[model samples]
Target: MTPARVTGTPGRTRVLIVGGGITGLAAAHRLRERLGPDAEIIVAEQAMRLGGKIHTVDFAGRPVETGAESLLAARPEAIGLAEAVGLGDAIVYPSDAKPALSLGGELLDFPAGHMMGIPGDPADVAAIANAKERPDNGLPILEPGADMSVGALVRSRLGDEVLDRLVAPMLGGVYAGDVDRLSVRAVMPQLAAALERHARLTDAVNEIKRPPSDGPRKPVFATVDGGLERLVTATSASARAEIRLGMTVRELRQTPYGWEVIAGPVPDPIKIKADAVILAVPASPAAVLLRAVEPQAAAALSGVAYASVALAAFAFDRVDLPERSGFLTPASEGKTVKAATFASKKWPHLGRRRQIVRVSMGRLGEEALLQYDDPTLAKTALRELGEHLGMRLPDPVEQRVDRWGGALPQYTPGHDARIAAAREALGVHRNIAIAGAAVDGVGIAACIASGQRAADTIAATVVAADR
Candidate 1:
C-alpha cells in the first residue's frame, strides 16, 4: 500500500471517509487493498480513540467486555476479518447454553423447546400454557395464534409464566431494549422463520435438534485471545489511508469537480478535498453531514434512530455466584436492569477464583444506572444480582462504566424501506457512499461487510473512470 496523495485534477479520485468506527477502519483497509498505489484516502474520527462501541476493558486482572461481547455463530464475516488480520488463533468461545433467566425473584431455566423467544405451539408443552389460558376459566392465553411482539409471542406460546418468568429477562440481557419493540425479524429472524414455516416455533426448533452424531464440532461463540481491540489495532496499522485523530467533520458539500469537507479547526480545515466520500458515521451524525449535499438522503439517514446504552463491569471473588454463567430480566416485570453476565463462570481464563461480572442497563434513550456515581451504580447492580441469584458479596474489587449516547440503531418495521430509499437517492450523486450498522445488521460481522462493500463500490467506480 502507498501513502495517500492529494491531486488537483478533476479526474484523480481521492476518497474521504468520515467516522473512525469499525466500519470506517474496515473501509479504509479495503480501499488500500483495491486502490493499490493510486488513490488517496483519508479517515477522520471524532473521538480520541477508534473502535466505536467494540470496547473491552481489563478490570482486576480479568477481561470484561464493556460493549459487544461476541459475534453470531452463523456469520462468517467477523471471524474472516480476524483471520485476515492474523488474530485467528485468539478466537475463544463461551458457554452460551449455560444462560438462565430471572423472574419475579426466582431463577428459572429457559424453556427447552423453542427457537430464540418464539415457541412451537403453546398447546404442545404440557407444563407451559398459552398467555390467554385461564387457571380455571374457559379462555386461552391470548387471542388465538395472533402475530404479536416477542413478549406477546412468548406469552401466548410459552404462557405468561414463561414470557414474564423467563423469555423477557433473557432477551433483556442481550438487546437492552423493550422486547416488544425489538422485532423478531430484526433480532431473531430464524425464530421468525420458524413462526412463518412450521406455524409453531417448537417444530422449527425440534427440527434443528436432531441428536448429535460423532463429528468435528466448531465453537459457537468467539473472541480474540488478546481481546477484540486487537482487531481494531491491526486494521489501523495496515491501513494506507491518512487517519487523523480528534478531527470531527462538521459538514459536507459537493463541488462541480468533486467534494469539499468542513472539519473542526485543523491548520487547514477546509482544504481536505476528495473525488468520492463514504459517510460511515452513525445515523445521527451522517444525517447532519448529508443534509447539504443530499437532502433526501439526509432525511432518510436522520429518520433511522438509535438507543442510548450503558454498561458496568465489576470484578469479584469467582465463587460469588455459583449458579449458571449469566441471565437476563424480562421487560414485563418492569425492572431497571436489562441483563447480567457472570464473567468468571463464562470465561475460565478471566480468573481462577476472582470473578468478573458485567451488568448492562438501559436501551436506546433510556437512563442507565451508570448515570449515578461509580460506587452507587456498583452497589445497585450487586443488590439486584443478590436478589435474583440469592447470593451476596461484600463489594466488587473493580468497577468500570461505559456509556454510548446514540448507538445501536433500532430497526423498526419500515427500516428496510427507509434504507432502500436512502440508498436510491444517494445513487444520483457521482461519488458518494454510505456504510454502517444502521443500514446493514449490527455486530462486528455486519460492520465489516458494510465497509468492504463501500470500498468495492469505490474501486468499481474508479475502474469505470479508466474506461
Candidate 2:
C-alpha cells in the first residue's frame, strides 16, 4: 500500500496512536497531559467501539461485564487512572465471598495463605496433598539469570499434586495457558526473585506473601460500579484526542520528518503523519506494522503467542448456589470449563435482582471448543457448571456468550528477553515505542503503566527535538 499524503501542520508535534483499547487510550491521555494542547494526538481503533476485551452489555436490565470484570488494585495504575478520570467514587470491591475449587466432583474451599496456588503452609491443603513431606529445608540454589517453567519449579520443589491441583488452576484462570509453558519470571516474578534469595520454593512464597507493613490493606481488586468499560469512556473523553473508529492501520514507515501510518481500507487507504507513534495493538498486528520499519522487532513480536477464551453469562430466575463466589477446575480433572464466577455474589453492586454467573471455557491448545456456535458453547458451560455445583441450573432471564479470540498473551519462558530484544531493536528509531499486554504484564494495571511509559518516552523525544 502506498503511503497516504501527510496532512500534519507545521510546529505542532503530532502523535498518532494505533489501537483504541485501554492501552492506546491510556497512552493518549498521558500524551495530552505531558504535551498539553500544543500537541496533536489521534487514536485509531479498528473496532467500531473502544475498550478492547473489556465489554459490558445490558443483561437482565443491569450492566453486566462480558469480558474483564475487575482490575488489580494492588498496583496503582488502574486505580490512579480511574480516580484521575473521576471514577473514584464509583469504585467497588468484591463482597465477602471466598472462591472454591472443584476437585473430584466436590466443591472445596480454596486454601488460603498461598501465592498463586503455592501454599505457604502445607496443612492448608492437606486434603489434596499427595506429597509425603513438605520441602521445609528449601529448594536448590537458583543461580542468577536463570529462568524455568513455573510448573517445573513447583513440581520439583513441591510435588505434582500441588502443581496440578493448586498452581495450575489458579494460574490457568488468569492466563489460560499451560503451566509447563509459562515462565516463572514473567508470570510469577516475586516468587522467582525470592527463589534466588531462598532455597525452598515454599519459603520463597512465604516471604513474598508476607505483608510489607502494618498499613491499612487495600482491596485486592476493584472495578467501576457501572462497568470497567466506563473507565475506557472516561479515559477517552479525558484524552480529548481525535478518535477514529473502524480504522485499521496496515503499515508503518519512518520518514525524514517523522513517521507515516498507512491505514484504512485496502481500496482507498489513508495515510496519517505524526512526529511520534505508539503501537498499542496485539502482537500479530504489531508485528505486521513493524516489519517494514523494524524487522528484528517484528520478528521478536511475532514469537508472542495468544490464547482465546469464551465467557458464558447466564442469568437465572431461581437457582441455589453455594454461599461462596466461584470455583476453578484443574485441567487434570479433564473439565471443559476452567473457571466460573458468581457475578452477583462477588460484585454486590450487580444486585440480587437476578442471579448472574459467568462460566469461562478454553485454554492453551483448546481452540476446538471455541468453534462451536454460541448456543452450543453456552450449553457446554452450563453442563459443566451443573456437574461442578451438583445441581441442575434452570435457564431463564438472559444468556450471552462472549468470545475473545487471541486475547490473552502467553508469557512463555524467556518472554522478557524477547520483549527486551524487540524494544532494543526499536530503540534506533526516534519517538516510536510499543505498549500493551504483549510487552508488559497482562493486567489492567500493567497495561496502563505500559501505555504511560510509552507516552513518556515519545513526549521526551518531542521535547528533545524542540531543543
Candidate 3:
C-alpha cells in the first residue's frame, strides 16, 4: 500500500473501492479505463500491504510464494492482467514433472486422464482407486441446474476408495476443504456440465479432459519468474489510485448524493464519500458492510465459509528427494501435512542452489493448526515430508512458515445460486457492486474476472447516471 495521499478529493467523480487484494486492484485498473482520467479512484485497504492470499518472501536467496504459487495459465484473466501490467516477459510455466500421492505408506503415481483425480477411464486409476464394480444403471449423474457435494457424486459412482484415496486429497490440496461438503458445481464446473450430458461419471470426466492433439499440450499453470508480489505491486501501480494503508472501512452509509464510508480508527474515523462503492473484501467483512444496506445479500454472503491453511518452506543443502515434483496425502491417512511441492524441481527457473520444498498443512476443520507456533508447523512439515519420501532428512539451511487463516473459501452446494441471489438483491440498490474469491470462484483468474465484472457493472451505472 502507498503511504502518499491525494492533494484533495476530486470534485468531478470520486469512486471508493474497498479492499486492496488482486480483486480490488483489478477493479481499480479497469475503472480507470471506464471512467477516464477525470475520475478520482481511491482504494481503501485495512492491511498495510496489498495481496491478501498472495505473498512472497526472500528465503535461501530466492523468492518463493508463501501463498499461491502459480496462475491458471489455461485461463486468460490472470496472465492477461500480468501482461497488461507490463510483466508479460516474466511469465514462466512449471516443468513436466508429475505429482505423486502418498498411499499405504508408499509414493504412488497420481491418476492420469482425470479431473481432480476423477479419472475418465476407471482402469487408469484402478491401481489407486480400488473402485468396486458398479453396474452402469443407465442413469445420468446430474441433471441440468442441479448441485451436489463432490464426495456424494464420486462415492456413489466411483466408490469409497476413490473418494478417500484420490479425489479427497486432490481437492483438499487446492481448497483445504473436504469433498463431502465442497460444491461440485462450483469447484469443477466443466465436470458438472459434462455430467449433465453423460450417464456415467467416467464418461463425464472424459468430456472435461483434453482431447488427443498432434501439437504439444500447453502447461496449465504459470507464475512470474521472480515472485508473485510483483504482480500485486504492479497491478496497484497500474491502477493509479490513491492507495491508503492501515485504514479499515468501519461502516457504509448511503447519502442522498451518493455513498459515504466511515473508515480509519474507531475513535477518529474519516467520512470519505463517493459517487460509487465496490465491496471487494472477503465474505465475512463484505457481509458486515452490506447488512445495513441489503440484508438478503448479507444473509447469502454470510453463509459462505472459509478454510485456513499453513505453508512451510524449507531449503535443504543436499538430501535424497524424489524425482517427482511433490506429493499429496489424503485426510484418511491421518497426516498432518496434506501436500508438499518441490519448488525448485517444479519451477526449474528457481535453480538447484538449494532444494526448496514447500509443505502445506491444515484443512477446513483444522483452523487450530494455524494457532501453532511457526517452528512447530515447520518441524511437522519436515518430519512428514521425510517420512513420505522414505528418508530421514538433515536440517534445512533456511526455513519459514506462513499461516493463512480463512484464506480459501469452501464453496458449499448451491454457491452459484447464493451469489446470484446476493447480486440480484444488491442490484435493487444503485452504485454498489460485489466481487472476490468468496462470491466468485477461488484462484487468481477467478478473482480477477470477478473484479472486472464488478467494475464494468459500476462503471456502466456511473456513466449512465452522468448522461
Candidate 4:
C-alpha cells in the first residue's frame, strides 16, 4: 500500500480526509472546488481504490453496478452533483421493470397506488382488501388512526393473506430489517406525514394526486451514464488534492496550532498535519475513530446501527421471465431475500436476451442467511428465482457473491436525537468534522450531500481562522 504524500508545513491549515469512499472523495473534491488557494487539502483512504461501496462491472456486453445501482429519482443532490462534475449527460432513468411481490412461492403483481404498502386509495386497497378483516384490510385514508409496524400496516391495508402471500417478503427483501422493529417514521417520514395530515393514508395520496399550484418542491434522484463510479473518478481527477490510498489513519489528535493524524504502520506510522478532518468510513469504524476525540459523540455514533447485506449477480443465456423488474419481500413473512433486481430489464445498457439479475439478501438483525458460501448462496438464489419466475432456469454462466458485513444503516426510532448529539459532541472541537453514510442518509446522493456540507464547513472555518 502506497502511503499518502505528506507535504506542507507541520502547522499549516490542511484538510485531512479519512476514508476513500464516495463521501470522503466528494468532501475532498468539494473542498478543492470551494476553498481558496491559501487552503491545502488531502484525502487519506484505507483502501487502494477510491470509490467505496460503488463498484461497477462491465459484463455480458453491459455495465452492471455491484454496489449502488441507481440514485433515487426524487433526490436532487446526486443529479446536481452529477451536473457539477460534468456527468449530466450520463443520467439514466429509474428501472422500467415492473416490480412483483413473491408470496408462498407464488409471484403476485404489486398492488397499484400502494407506496410500499402504505395504502393511498381505497380502490387500490380493494385489490387485496379482505372484507372479514376490519380496518386492517381497509384503505389507508379510510383508517383514521393506525399506528402499526409496516407489517401491520400492510396486513391492515392489504390483508394477512396478502401480507403473508406478498407484502412481508417484498419489504423484508429491501431493508432486510424486521418490519416490527423497523420504524416507518424514520425510514419513510413522508408517508408518516401523509398519515398525520390526512388522518387517513389514502386521503394524503388523493391530495398528492391533485396537481399542486405552488409549494415547497419535492426531492428528485438521478444516476450518471457510465455509472456512479464515473462521478467518483471524475471528482478525484479534478480535486487537485493529493490522495493517499491503502493508508489507514490509526490515530487523530488536536494540536495547539491545528490537527495531527497518524496513519500507516504502527512501528513507524506516517504523521500528517491538517487544519480539519472528515471521518467518512462506516458507522462502526467511524465511531471507534471518534472515541478519543469525543467519547459521547462516539457513543452516539455507535448507536446508529448497521445491517449486514449480501449481493449476488447472475447472467443467463435466455431471458424469458415475465417483466418482474424489482420486487421486495417484507420481513414479517420471514423470507430469505429482501429484494431482487432484474438488471438487464432495468437498465438499457445491461441489454436484453442476456439477462443480468442482482439479488439482495439479509438486512439489519436478520443476517443468518449471509453465512452461506458462494456456491450455496448462488444455488439458494437460483432456487428462489425459479420459484418466483414460475419455471426452472438454465444455470447461470456467470455468478458472484458480494458480501457486505454492514452495508446499509438502519434508521431506528430516535435516530434524529442520536445524530444531533453526535454532531454537538464533535462541534466542541475546532478542526474535526464527521461526514459519511451514517450521518444524514445512507444513499449515494445523501453521502455526497454530507461530504459537500462538511467541505463547506471546513473551508469556512479555515478562512475565518486565517482572518
Better structure of 2 and 4 per TM-score: 2
Which digits, one per residue and each the tens of the lDDT, describe model 1 over residues 154-268? Answer: 5544466656544555565555556556665556655555555554445555655434558955666677765678888888777767777888888688888667887856554
Off by over 4 Å in 3: 1-10, 136-139
What does the lDDT read for residue 137 in candidate 1? 29
| Candidate 2 residue runs with Cα over 4 Å from true position | 1-5, 132-141, 212-217
Q: Could you tell which candidate, 3 or 4, scores higher by TM-score?
A: 3
Error of 3 at 453 (Å): 0.8
Candidate 1: which stretches are off by over 4 Å?
1-13, 121-167, 190-217, 266-268, 368-370
List the lowest-lDDT window of 10 residues for candidate 1.
136-145
Encode model 2's per-residue lDDT on 1-467: one tens digit a residue: 56455566787889999999999999999999999987899999999999997888898887898888899988899999999999999999998898899999999988778899998877778887664334455444466657899988888877899889999999988999989999998988877788888877767888989565688667799989989999999999999999999999998989998999888998778888999999999999999999989999999889889999999999987988788889998998888899999988888999887899999999988988889999899888899899999998897578999989889999988888888888998999988999999988888889999999999999998989988
TM match of model 4 to true structure: 0.86
- What digit string (tens of lDDT, one per residue) describes model 3 on residues 208-243? 788877899888999999999999999999889999
After TM-score superposition, what is the CA distance of residue 286 in candidate 1 from its true location, in Å?
0.7
Q: What is the per-residue lDDT of model 4 for residues 400-420, given as tens digits with 9 covering 90 to 100?
A: 888887777766655655777
Colliding residue pairs in candidate 3: none
Q: What is the C-alpha RMSD, rounded to one decimal, of candidate 4?
A: 4.6
lDDT (CA) for every model shown? 0.70, 0.89, 0.89, 0.72
* Order of quality (lDDT): 3, 2, 4, 1
